[model samples]
Target chain A: MKGILRSLLTVIKNTFIRSITVLYPYDRIIIPYNSRGSIRLVVDLDTKEIICDGCGECVNACPLKLISVEKVSHDKKIKNFYVDISRCLFCGLCEEACKKDALKMNFNYELAERDFSALRHDIDKLTEYAKPKVKEFWKS
Target chain B: MENRKIKDYEEIEGYDIYIEPQFRPFGFPVGLYIALKDGVIINIKPEFGYLTTGVEKVVEGMEIDKAIPFIDRVDSSSAISPELTYCIGLEKTFKIDVPLRAKFIRTALCELSRISSHLLWLTRLANVLGINNALHYCLREREEVLHLIELATGSRLTPNFIRVGGVASNLSPRFIEEFRKFFRSFRKNFNMLKTFFLENELVVNRLNNLGVLIEEDAKNLAITGPNLRALGIKKDVRIDDTYGIYDEISFKIPVGEKGDSLDRCIVRMGEIEQSTSIISQAFYKMPEGEIRTYTEDINQFSGNTRSHIECPHGELAMEISIDEGKITKLRIKSPSYNNLLAFSRAVLGESVEDVEVILTSFDICVCEVDK
Candidate 1:
């Protein structure tokens, strides 16, 4: 009988507490600065150039073999780089293996799309999602 | 043993009751075949493993670096175990000593994962028992743990943070401070949760003595983790194997008297407290140093090594045979594979309606077994 009353009282106390449910698409919560969401190319801070030299380190580093890099020039400069985000585990190995630090896992997580074609991101699409390093945000 | 009795289905009359593979419990696909005699279960022929990824086949012939991510994918709920186990195996095979700071960080992350997994199990058990408030509270707590994980590892669910020699990144001062705040309030919050569930009459009445697993049976059936611990066994892989810096830390292994469903749930609850304390201790004693030591060339490595990690579920052991730095053969023994066998025996003589509740209490994840 005491246990029942205690449980009832606990429930009554909890009823007035704030709800933890996040109303997605209406109100947004800040993801942590280090949160890994989507893989993207990095930009050199000084040069303002997309840092990828068409080197295929990421292509080799990818666990699922989802990344493909094509060389189109005599200097072995990259012509096309494709990442099938649909098949990506988002493990961030490609970002870590980039010798030039030219790849990063960005914080923009809203990647859901209706069409499967939209999920396969090319180099241009991947570069557009790139932003400054998370260290800059950490300072603020 | 005096009270144990296997009911005969031939004598009892009732509606032909059988929940097929389609209408399974826990909203997951599992073949939990049970025969009910007058609303009571007469026999259970458990058929698990619907979703098999064949990770062993995938890892063979793959480079050691690439295989860590796939190894982490084996059990999503406890993602760190297989990754850590595989890395530890590589380190042992190649003769590499990990840094002290890295060992502390690995232990902290593992304890955090255990807490998060237990919270998830608590929510599932509460939902199965029709306790809405407990579900909300457990989910709320779990979200906080996930945020802490995200702060340290960049990803919340599948971090793949631990590498061969050390963790991927060092612990930031901000994360350490936020973790202190979390640690301060955790005990209080967990106590309230315990009071609501462990002491609640409804939960006790429904869960107590439902599926009793004797200690002898648990050992003979190859049961591990909280399921085996609930049967009054003081055997924990952390203490027995003394892996990592676990030999340096001080924590109690909570053991149960009767191996019932309620005991299983309580044992997990006790473990959450122990894991929290262990994390706090690991943080306090953490030294300032490099997180990782650069290993020598990978291509020249050769050896066959086996590693065991105390996962949230149980001991996850992995054997890797490396030839010229390439994985030639791999074998994984997940705890869920053995726990499912014990689950098949535990669910016998239980009613049809209470099947989901009993199963969740043991915290047997079907995907882990299938992996």
Candidate 2:
């Protein structure tokens, strides 16, 4: 009988407390800056150009071989870069292996798609969502 | 009466046999075969192999550094323990020295994971017990711990934070501040939870004296963790085998006198308190230094080593054999596999209604079992 009263008191006290739930679609919680989200190509702040030199360090660093890099010539010019997000683990190995600060994991987590083909992100798709002026938290 | 066959098992005249197929609420596909007599359980046979990803086979021949992500998924709820065990095995084999700051951060993260894992168990137990309010409260506290992990490791469930020699990154200042805030309020909140759930008449009446496991039977079945501890055995991998900085940290191993379902719940609640104290101690004694040590050449190292740690479930150990940078063999001794055997034994002679209660009390992770 005492235990029942205590539990009832707790339930009553909880009624006055504010709810911690964030109603999704109506309101969104702020994601942390360093969260491992979708992969994106980092662009130079002034030049506005993708900073990848086509060195393929990220390709070697990736354990799953989801990243593919192509170079046009020996002058460090990138021809095509692609990332298959279908099976990406998002371990941030590619971002850590980039010596040129050209690759990063941005804070865009909403990557749901209806079609399977749209999941494969190319250089244009990667750069399309790239934030130019966002401070790099992983570097620190 | 003539003998008959049901689902490949011989059915006797006086007993009833049924197979409980995997359900959605159980979170994993682990079928249970129960043999009943007079509404009491005569036997229980657990089935596995429904969710096997063959993690050990896939990790073979891969570099030691590259296997962290794969290992982190073995037990996704408390991912840090397996990752830490794998890193410790490689570090011991290669004789690599981890920085002190990294060690402190690792210990803190481990305790945090333990707290979160236990809270998850509590949520499941509450759900099984039909206490919806307790489930909500447990989930709320678990979300706080997961958020802290996300703030530090960039991911919540699978942090993949621990590396071979040290951790991947240092603790941020915001994380430290939030941890302090969490530590301050968690004590009061947990007290409220205890009053709301553990001390309730419904939970006490339902769980007390149910599914009692004897110490001798538990030892025979090789049951570790709170289940064994509930039988008054003071056995813990963290204490017995002093891994990481556990020798430096001071914490009590909570044990229960009776090996009943309620005793298991009480022991885990005590453990949550001890884990919180451990995190605070690690935070206080944490030193400022490098988080990782750069190894010049890891491929030239070749040896075999084993490392073990006390996970939230029980003892989790990893055995690794490396041949000049490539892993030749990797074996994970998960606690849930042994706990499943113990569960099959503990469920005997109990009524059918208490089966879920006893199962959740053991807190068996089928993913770990099938891994």
Candidate 3:
């Protein structure tokens, strides 16, 4: 009987405490600074061009081979880069393998899509997602 | 009606009952086949292989460094154990010396994983016992631990933080401070949870002396972890086979007096306390050094090695045979396989209603069993 009363006390105490949940659409929780979400390509702040040199480092580092890089013959620039985000492990290995800091994992975790092909990101989508503001936010 | 001869039901064999398998909310599905007689279980057989992903076979021929992510998914509840076992095995085979700071960080993360895993088990047990409040409380505490892991390793369930030579990144001061704060609150809340569960008359009566697994059967079956310790056997891979910075830190292994369902619960609860102390010790004694040793020429490594660690479930071991930098053979000896076998044996002679209680008490991860 004493145990039952103690349990009841605990239940009562918990009832008065503030809730820890956030109303998803109305409110949001602060994600950790180091949280790994989706992969993005870093762009040059001044030139607005991708900093990747088509070096194939991330391609080699990827275990699942989700990344594909094509280089232009004229100036060793990235002609095309594709990432299959549908099957991406998001393990952050590609970001770690980039030598020029051209690859990063941003906080844009909302990657759900209705169509399968929509999930496969191209160079334009990747570069557009790497906003200069996001880089500055992480610096702090 | 009088011309027909009636057969005696007692002369026939025991009835066979098959429990339809269903997907557990946590993942994996388990079914049971029971032989019943007079409301008692004559024999019980557990069915596995519902969630097999061929983890071991998939890792074969992959590079050593790239296989960490796949191995991390072997046991989704505690991802670090198998990754650590595999990394330790590789490190041993290639004769790589992990830095002291890396060792301390690994120990801290591993203990944190243990605590979170035990909390998850507690939530499931509470759910099974119809204690809705305890279930919610356990989940609330478990979320904090998962957040701490995410803060440190950038992912919640599968950190993929530990590497072959060392850890992925250095621990920030903010993470350490936050962990200390969490530790303080967790200690107090844990006591409350203990009293709420253990001291309750309903829980004690329901769990005490139910599905008793004798020490001899546990030993003969080669059971490890809390289930084995519940039988009053003081055997832990972390102590018997010391690894990482465990030799530097001091802690006690909690043992139980009886090998019943209640004893298992007590032993796991005691483990959560021990794990917290270990995390504090590892953090306090942590030294300043590099987090990872530079292993530029990993492709030249070639050898076969086996490494085992005390997982939250039981003894999780990984064996690797590398030839010219490619994995030729990889095998994982998961603890759940043996625990499932023991569960099968323990449920015999118990009433049919106690099967779920005994199954949850064993804390079997079908993912590991199917892997």
Candidate 4:
């Protein structure tokens, strides 16, 4: 029974020590370097060049069929890419197939949206979402 | 009163426990379970896959190599592990070994993926336990690990780095240096997690004797990996000295004495440390070699094949029947399949409020279980 009291006392101590949890939305957590967030097709913003060869590999990879890479280049290339985060499991298989590193995983867990369509993005929008997290390691 | 000379319920080799004892779990099948309480768990009953999307069936009709991405979807979290298992299994069947460099990178990516998966499981359980602070912290570290994967493989989750023969690409020196730094930083912060939430007495109280899976029942249930270890059975496919370069490395397999919620947590934490050790060793010994070893001349020793991997959950066994370099049949038996027994047995005689604690303790993956 004394052990139970000690355990209770410990819980009380911890509760006091950890009462300062961040309120999540009003005060966001600065994501660490190792967080896995929504994935994106890598697009080089400097040149607007897409590394995907329009192979439809990613489209074929997704179980949910959340990706559709299309190429409007003169010869039906897979330059334009679309990913629907709503359906995407964030499995990272689509990025796995891209030999060019054109698609990448970036941390941005705040992907709450009321509209379902907002989850889907074209190649251009994916580039916007693909921003690298400038993780402040020392901040911790 | 029943005679003590007869079965004392405790002395019985096994006992049967229906999980949905209140009602038949057919129409409203959120979760279904059947536990054999032969002094522990004997057999597990699950019907989550009753309504199937037929992923494996669909793959049989598709082109062979095109199946990598589809395989990733089977259990979505750690796509790299499944991809590696399938790609390597296919390569082995065709007698194609990847370049030394690719093999090293493959192991590296696999460890990162395992860490990411454990992080997800940790957060999920912590969330269920109402410890949201740990969830954020775990996800934060998971993002760092994902970035390391991202730097090498491009995609964070579904890294298709490993092809049938060799890995598709290589990691840069700078990326390697950065990744090593990240691993070091993560190590420093890991111990604080225990202090953060694990040390909380309420958490331990909720988990203490809840969902107990004794030794004998664990073995009968075909329990493998950490779940088995949590039951005081030191059965780990990885340490069994099996395939996929595991023999080349040195590591300790952590085991638990009581198959309770706390023991399960200890096993997972021990795995985190052990996985880190393996990654560090793989990192130091990485060699440079051609990543892929398949020939364009498809006619190689290809018929039917199987390869095995020890995942964070347990033994990930895959069997493939190939025809003309294309996969005819691919059957995956994930470790998640056997864990249901442990989960269901742990929940019996448990307080209603502690159900989620037991469930989360088992680290049940709905997708993997359903798959």
Task: Give the Cα-based TM-score of candidate 4 against the true structure.
Answer: 0.70
lDDT of 3 by residue, B1-371 (tens): 53331232232335377665663556648977788888899877676788889987898899988988998889989998899999898888789999999999998999999999999999889988899989989999999999999999999998889998899999889998888899889998999899777999989999999989977888888989999999998999998989998988899999998899999999999999999999998888889989998888888889999999999999998778999888999988999999999998888888987888889999988889998
If candidate 4 were superposed on the true structure by all CA atoms, what would the RMSD be? 9.6
TM-score winner among the candidates? 2
**Top-lDDT candidate index:** 3
For model 4, residues B1-371, the per-residue Cα lDDT tens digits are 56852543454334343343224221223344334443444444444664355667778845555677677776666888777778767677566766776777777778778788888778877788877666767887888887777777766667656777777666778677887788777876577566555566777777777788877677777778777888777777666646566678898888888888888888888888888888888878887666667577663335877777877777787898877656678788877767866676556664445655676677655556656
By DockQ, the best candidate is 3
Candidate 1, superposed: residue stretches over 4 Å from native: A44-48, A75-77, A129-140, B1-17, B25-27
List where candidate 3 sits over 4 angstroms from the true fold.
Answer: A130-140, B1-15
DockQ of 1: 0.60
The predicted structure with the larger TM-score, 2 or 3, is: 2
Model 1 pairs in collision: none
Question: A8-97 in candidate 2: lDDT tens per residue?
Answer: 888899999898889988998877778999898888878877788888889988989999988887677787889999899989888888
Error (Å) of candidate 4 at residue B3 is 47
Model 1 DockQ class: medium
Worst 10 residues of 2 chain B by lDDT: B1-10
Local lDDT at B224 for model 2: 84
- Give the least accurate 10-residue stretch of model 1 chain A, judged by summed lDDT: A128-137
Per prediction, the TM-score for chain B is 0.93, 0.95, 0.95, 0.85
